[model samples]
Target: MTLEYLDYTIVFLSLGSSIAIGVYYGFFNKSKTSEDYMFGNRQMKVLPIAISLVASQINPLTIIGFPSEIFVFGITFGFHFIGMIFVVLILIYLIIPIFYENNITNCYDYIEKRFDRRTMIFLKTLFFILGYLYIPVYSYISSQALSFVTTGINVHLINTIVCSICVMYTMLGGLKAVVWTDVLQNFVMFFALLFITYIGVTEVGSFKETFSRASDIGIFEVNTNLDITSKNTIWNCFLSGVLLFTCLIGFNQSCVQRIVSLPTIKDSRKAIILFFIGFIITVSIVCILAVVMAAFFNDCDPLKSGEINQSDNILSYFVQKLSINTRGIQGMYMACVVCASLSTISANINSLSCTLYKDCIKPFIPNSKNNNLIPKIIALLSGVFLICSGFVVEILNSTAIQIITTSLNLVFSTYASTFMLGFLAPRIHSRAMFLSNIVGFIVILGVIVKGQFFSGRVQYEPIEKTFSTDC
Candidate 1:
């Protein structure tokens, strides 16, 4: 069969498998109670939680766009993960203390307890916004992957279809099913990474050959200067990455819900440790894969050739190259891409649903503690609304995507300072906590906006963006 036929076959096969899995999860593992739905009945094992963490973090962007970053930038960007290690440490020592101390159901619960009713409501509302808004980035990634393996399909159209599939399953099964499905996706993820790594190494000859090629292209660099102005520098990585990841992992409802899955706080701690190990391994594998792709395609630059304008297109380009050389590998490659996209989107939907139920709808529902239907209804509605929001994003010509992505990133970032002030600083009144968070949120948002909009005028080169304009 021709490569085009094989590509079509792959998408068809993937869609079939996705539907089958969703149906099985929906029917067999339906949630019987709020605890069962929200926290997997609080009986989660360490391995599943670990796998879920990896699944949550390894979005299609990380799989597709990240390797592209490594290819275009260099191994220096590995420092981002390095700082992530320290961020996990911060979570363990700093953030987890409050979580364990308070026996919190949602991360935002801490804000309500430490601050006031207004603060709690506001913060939870903020997270609801953050969660719903972030859906499009996953949609964008899925659409891009679909485009890679299909012909004559619009990317936005593919995104909406994929988003609908995800919302349908998540709305049907709730969080437990999502976690169970994540375990399977995590394995698919590992297999996918290993497959790409194998193909890349074989294409480049060997490990030594791959490293030699990467070195020839100047892909490895270890710089010690801690300058915020220098992108990917160790110092800037320490500052920005610590802040970024603390919010991403510690504060994110997606990550929080997973950690709270275990039976006890101690088990939660164990899951966090396992998550750190899995996170390191998963990130390291992706980095190695990125290097492999760079070496294998050392002479090709699609942007330079005007084949594509964005770094995100690199994975499709590489996959097409592999399809030309092998039989059916392209099919497996596309399956991996779809699995990555589906897993992350599934987790996001699950978490978003949980937040809406616990923080938004539950408070209003009379005797919500006794009536579990409220949570289920809220979860279902949240998924439906977010899918609509995804379509709205598609219509707005990309602004919806930007707002969703940036709002979540900034909201998650404040999680670090919010949790720190609440847990670490003693004698902080609810008034103080409220005032500090408001002040900090405004200040941080201003800084980020100024940096993004007036970056050319200020000429302040952040460590992560130092090399962004080089090409």
Candidate 2:
């Protein structure tokens, strides 16, 4: 069930290609200023930016997260797409125009102009908190995937190496390198899903057979019960989806950074539209793939049978089960997982560096203004922070999707009302908004602390997934 040399070769080639991209951009397409390093001088290609957005949105945590989630919770996540549509609309017509009109590169930078340094710093702190909580989860997931590929491998070593590779290219190549490598890694993601799906469906007999098995598992049912207290109901998913997607997609620095990277407002809007389209397609495929995995594992549950350590690693377990007949499939899946992590890791690290320099460091030192090397060095340092923080994820008991949703929920509670009121309600006093922001952050931070340590992890009841060892 182990990967052969062919698989290792494929994985290494992917890793090597990503580094090569960094070298090319770092040397040939060098950024002359910090602005160019961050946003490609606002003259970057539109399509690559669009694809990179998709990659960052659907990184490795998601590649495995969706299937694990679907295997247990069904398609509740899909209902969130409805709210996401509206979020995209707001980003395109309403929010993006403000950033574009103001010539704002760092999203937090806009806060300083509209309000004050204090308000900007408050929002910036929330952004940093979100990044620190979630980015490491992605790195943890990537390392777990590699460890699954080669059983008994050192998890920390895998995490360190893979994260280092991603950070190296990010620091060397800048945003252009990140985007182009994303284009490459995104392709790897698509191919991995395709290969697994085709094989899985074939093994399950046919597409029709697979769907029937998924239905038999009861995950195919759409719970339309309209109750806020309910977990998997369509009604709950819709409301939570809108709220959460707004925080994750609308306000997240990673998404905003990509949108601002393009030149014109028109281009930025077009890229957002393209990103929406790409996301829907990619998510549709992931959902379908999850169903396929569910169908294949319908009878003998990997979790119940002890075939995988966790549901998050189920996709890797399934791949290993299929490895007897395949040689290089493990490598392909590994590459896909690695690519997913790299896309988000690099994007957020890049975004993190910008916020650190612009909001955190530069304001204090005023002398570091407009310096390119400082940002690059900050990016490199952020990479170290990402690696160290990522290891902390080992202590969490929930799956990737659960962890992400929980963190985003807390973050939304902290910054959403304040952030929106800041831009949408110009007549509102900045002091009032800042006060609300402080109260919201303190309340949510308390909830997070109590839930994680004192009380218990706050979560809704989930549908019972019928898992058994006996077929």
Candidate 3:
């Protein structure tokens, strides 16, 4: 189960290449203007940017979390893909044009143009805070994956190492480096999943056998319950997916920056379409891998057998067991996890830097010659913050996926709503928007409090357990 020297070499080379790419862009091909550094001179090709968009969106959370979700729940989670298609269509037709037409570096720039500086500042502050909180979860997930591969190393040290590498590259390369590395990482991620799925299915005899075993245990059950509180119902999946994508792809700064980095609106739209294709394929593969893992362990469930400490670790456990004598497979899997984490962390750092310098720091130091240095410094500071926050995550000892999902919901629940108000309801006065935002914020807070403290009225009953002995 331990990683061999060759396995370690494979992972090191993978990560090392990412840093090298960052160094190449950050130093040798230095971006002269803020535009070049922040938006890649607006000359990036659609294909790489498309791949980057997909890569940045698929992080450790999706890589690890999605499989864990499918394992614990069922195939009903796949219905979210339907909702994703709906959201991406909206983005291509309605959202990207506005941002591209405005030629904005930060997504919040449209807020200032549409409403007033006060409203823009409020949303910018929220983005900055939420982004800061979110980056740590990425680090925590990367460190967790690193722990599986390098069991001798401490998780805290792993976090520091992973975050340091991400910061170094992001500080050096800027947006171009992030995009190019994402192209590479996305391939690694796909290959890893393909390899794991192939091995898992082969071990289970065939794809037919795999599904037959899964179906025997009712893994194909779709949640048709109408109850709003039901976690994975079709309605819940569709609505939550719509909201999640509206916030993430429609309004999130990290996503918007990548979309706008392309040369033209047409290219950005194309990138969105390409991204959707890649997203669906990759997500479907991961979900199938989840079912495959379930089939592989149908007889000896890892959670029931206490072979793994957490559901999130089930994939890692499966990888280790499958890679007992298989040399580079484990390293490849670890590389996949690292690539997923690094792409996301780097994108967030770059986007957050862009947000801070453009919205917060530049106003004070207007027309300064050293304005370019602001983003670099902020990128470095962001790395340190992520590392520190990662330690806090470790201290909390929470599941990375749950913490991330909850945090995103709390931080971004009203973001898409506010953006829609600005974009679609232009005649709405800034005062009215401001007041509405305040009231909406209060209502969201009340709902959160109610869910946390006054949830006695609704209770979740566990699904009946039925394990299959036909592995």
**Could you give me the TM-score of model 2 versus the true structure?**
0.93
- The sequence of per-residue lDDT tens digits that candidate 1 reaches over residues 1-471 is 135666558656665665666677567756666777778777888888878887888777777766876776667667777777787777777777778778876887778788778777767777766666666666666676667556557776777666666666666666766776677777777776788788878888999999877777667766676656664566665566667677878888788888877777777777778877887888889999877776776666565667677666777777777767776676667667777877888887778767767766676777655455655566566656755665566565433224544675578656666677777777778887777778888987887787567545654221221122222
Poorest lDDT segment (10 consecutive residues) of candidate 2: 454-463
Q: List candidate 3 stretches off by more than 4 Å.
A: 369-371, 454-465, 469-471
Looking at model 2, how many pairs of residues clash? 0
**Candidate 3 lDDT by residue in tens digits, 1-471:** 677887888789878999899989977998888878888878899999989988987888887878877787888887877788888878988898888777775778788888888888888887887888878988788778769766678888888888899899999889999999999899999998899889889888899999988877667788899988787899989888888877887788888888887878899888999999999899988999988987888787777777777778878888887887566888888888988989999999999998778766777886754357889999999998888887688777446765677667865776877788877886898888877887887888787767656455765442343565443
Q: In candidate 1, where is summed lDDT lowest over 10 consecutive residues?
A: 460-469
lDDT of 2 by residue, 301-393 (tens): 777777666778888888887777766888888888989989889988888887677666676875564576777898888778877876678
**Number of the top-ranking candidate, with lDDT as the measure:** 3
Residue 338, candidate 1: C-alpha displacement in angstroms: 2.0
Question: How close is every model to the real structure, measured as TM-score?
Answer: 0.88, 0.93, 0.95
Candidate whose TM-score is highest: 3
Q: With candidate 1 superimposed using the best TM-score fit, by how many Å does residue 163's alpha carbon deviate from the native?
A: 1.6
What lDDT does each candidate get?
A: 0.71, 0.80, 0.83
Ranked by TM-score, top first: 3, 2, 1
